[model samples]
Target: MKELRSQAIVLRTMPLGEADKLVTMLTREAGKVKAVARGSRKTKSKFSALVEPLTLGSFLLHAGKTFYTFIQGELLKSYTGLQHDLERFVHAQYFCEICDRCLPEGEPAEAVFHLLLTALETLEVDPHPARVARCFELNLLEELGLKPALDACRICGKSGGPFRFDPLEGGLVCAECPRPASSFPVSAASLAVMKRLLAYGFQKLSVCLLSPQSQSEIHQVCLGLFQHIFDVRSLRSLQFLKAGKPS
Candidate 1:
């Protein structure tokens, strides 16, 4: 069997027989991989903590017929701060889940890998989890080649001012253009925020502010576009997030 080593972020883990675990991770070089971590469930297992979701580490594995077998792991960052807040934790999970769903196995996803690492770091320091989540979503869409057009109207190709986001048409429609049945009114402030979020890097998100109305608009538009593009009925972590909200 061939041995491989790479930097990876733990995405999820499932219990195996008694002491083993099925660990899924996104590797910087190898993209998504599912490996069997023998004895990882045991208290004394060196990989016990490193296999938790969102933990960044370097992993050594052996190729098997169907899955990779974990040999050893060197921990990098555990991202333990996420556990201190429920909202943050849920958002982190949502991020991981989306990555898990979007990435294909064994395909190099360097951009996505880096984006996820940066997003986790941002989540730990950024006060607004919603903003981080939205930014991450927009970046992910771009990385996946599903970025919606925001510069001009999707219909008339007109530039400037109060636009309506039409997920079905895959972008904004100007005020002068006829609104599609599925279009929703989008304010200039929300459009500006969306543009900035898509343009700025994660490090600059801490200072970016959004009004409550703008936040709702961006959320609705992104979520609608995601569902329309990916055909994902729902995300479990997002459901958990909505359930925990004050609404």
Candidate 2:
């Protein structure tokens, strides 16, 4: 059996039998992995602290014929501190759940793993958590070839001063598309901001000048697009966030 060590984020955990856990993790090298952690559920188990949801850690695994044994987890960052504030905790959870659900169907993209780490790290201090999340979703879409139409009409290839997102077309549709009225109406400014976000790297997020209104609009657009594509109402954390403000 081969041994592997890599950085990963805990996406979820479920109890198995007793004193054991089944963990789902998104790793830098493996994309996503499911492993068994023995005795982690017990009060005195050294592994309990390491298997938390959304915990970022480096893990050592012993690959077996059918599965891997989680030998150890060395914590890198645990954002649980933010959970003290209900809203921040909700937003973070929503962010993680979206990531866990929206990833592509194949080998894990290493770049995305790093991007997620950076965004989660930013949430620890950055004030514009919403902006960071919106940007991350857009980039994830682009990487997965699920990018929405922004600047141009997905149908007529119309050069954009205006266009509406027509998810049926998988992007904006031009007037040339029959019954373009069926498309969701999108404002020109919204298109511009969306374009800029996709055009720039995520690390450049802080440098942009965005008004409060613009930020909210971007958030709506992202949620709409993501929910439609993934077919989920929203992240579970979003509801918790709606119930309280970040501290």
How close is each model in CA RMSD to the real structure?
1.8, 2.8
- How would you encode candidate 2's per-residue C-alpha lDDT over 86-139 as one tens digit per residue? 555666677677777777433667877876777777777767776676677677
Instruction: TM-score each candidate.
Output: 0.93, 0.86
Residue 37 accuracy (lDDT) in model 1? 91
Per-residue CA lDDT of model 1 for 1-247, tens digit only, reads 6987999999999999989999889999888999999998999998898899889999999989888998888999998679889889898999998888777888889999999999999889888888888899888888887787888998778888688899887799888988788999899888888888888857578788978888788878878877885644477898897778612
Tell me the spans in candidate 1 whose CA falls farther than 4 Å from its real position: 231-233
Q: RMSD, model 2, all Cα superposed?
A: 2.8
TM-score of 2: 0.86
List candidate 2 segments past 4 Å from native. 104-106, 175-182, 209-213, 241-247
In angstroms, what RMSD does candidate 1 have relative to the true structure? 1.8
